[model samples]
Target chain A: MRWFWFDRFTEFESGSHATSVKNVSLAEEQVHDHFPGAGTMPNSLILEGLAQTSGMLVAEYYDFQERVILAKVPRLRFHLRAVPGDTLIYRAKIDSIEESGARVSVTSHRGEELQAEAEIIFAHLDRHAEQRQLFEPNDFAKLLRTFGVFEVGRKPDGSRIRMPAHLAEAEARYRSQAQA
Target chain B: MPTQDEIFHKVQSALVDALGVDEDEVKPEATLVGDLGAESIDFLDIVFRLEKSFDIKIPRGELFPEDILTNADYVVDGKINDAGLEQLKKRMPFADLTGFEKNPAVQDFATMLTVQDMCNYVASKVDGKA
Candidate 1:
């Protein structure tokens, strides 16, 4: 099963905030057997959508130089159940970010109603050279494209955000290795 | 400058939000690990919330000194030596090391962090500014 919870990002501002949309559908595998006859999207998966939306924002803030991993969810409260046909909009705002990690405030909304809110944390592991391949820069860059991050992403100065050089280099190397 | 009680309350609120513990469970002498059940990751969460609540920049290693714990020179057989304890004391003046001084076990050090110590640490950071 794919871990892609969000469909596309409508708003992405590097480091500060980002908004993404997720369309719940019974056709998807995640909600197939959630309740058998009556399937509803798992709250955990909704949380994942929120995290991914925010995690990408945080990762882009540092130009993807650091390996970002979700460390904790300090607070999360679900106000409504998200079922098939519901379009959930997840918004993630960076409250504080530093070299060590970042703290993000995320919320999920269905139209005008607030579905969920949370405070999530991320930790950086750039110093771990041995585990550098874990992030798989090429695959990550592709994932960003699939999620439409680059299309809507912008820098703090309002300039369009560009893909990092490292990811491009990694993709080139991977293609060469595959050909070889 | 905020009063001691105000600092304690703010610290308490941060702990409650971070650890998902009850407001009453957070007391002066309540051990963060033992009583409130805060794991290593929760410390980062607590620090983040505290920074947000108090609006102060808490540089890494100021609130929790992980470096001393991990240093080979300080730790021996999963225990902190007297010299190590001295360094820890210098790093965390707000913490009362008298109790932990006896055991000085590395694992037990986390459990020694009482809520009062956190308040003291915040007080030291915010008070000195005033």
Candidate 2:
């Protein structure tokens, strides 16, 4: 199963970069599992959140046309442990985009305090060669919308980016069905 | 270079995998969303599969030209004028606009996009003609 660590995007720039937020809540199931009463958000989960943030940014470069798998964590540094009620702000910037893969620099913050930083590499998998679909498009689209990828996304020039026509139509259908 | 038939077959397979639709439903004339039940997210999956399959790069807004609607020069009185229509036609040469041209509502543009259109677009890109 695919994992979506981040909650939603607050700022999305197609191809170049993106920013998302994840609220670590006491109610999360993992919190109880990690510690019986402490309820601390694990540092690994924080790294996963950074991965989700940067992964989406890299995927958008191909218009989500390729399978972007996390290849490596060349570097990572954690400054603090997070508890419930802490909001993690993840920012990902493209270091370079290439045909083989992409390199992204990511940092996580907790309200003016640095929580963690990392450099991640993603491999663009050839789905055709694999002959396997990693995600159902409908489910993936809903995930993108739920994360506000299209709602706040923009071009480098600062113009609002339009959601692809097919995605817009699907979102409309989902909305109507949700209302019904 | 892959033949048009190969491209079409690959495109159909991609759509079937991405949208979870039957192979029989992915006909050339079938509308992706209308007939085949593709949602917006499916397009991303389809494009991704196609790019990986064909070993090509598809820029955002190239396969689906939503940016045209945002261009002021193309939209006049809330409708696409001749120039706008021409530009769209050039961008999406595979789409059949016969019915859309008759009515020309902004919504019709997306609705008019068909399975054959995507197949053609991928073919063009693979052939280095796009």
DockQ score of candidate 2? 0.02
Please, what are the lDDT tens digits per residue for candidate 2 over residues A94-138? Answer: 866766577678999999999999878687786667867667666
- In candidate 2, which residue ranges exceed 4 Å CA deviation? A1-3, A165-180, B1-130
lDDT of 2 by residue, B58-78 (tens): 887887787887688988777
Pull out the clashing pairs in model 2.
A65-B48, A166-B40, A167-B40
- Candidate DockQ values, in order, are 0.77, 0.02
The TM-score obtained for chain B of candidate 2 when compared with the true chain B: 0.89
lDDT of 1 by residue, A141-171 (tens): 8898899988999998999998899998988
Tens digit of per-residue lDDT, candidate 1, span B33-80: 999999988888888888889888899988889889989999999999
**Every candidate's TM-score, chain A alone:** 0.93, 0.88
* Candidate 2: CAPRI quality band: incorrect
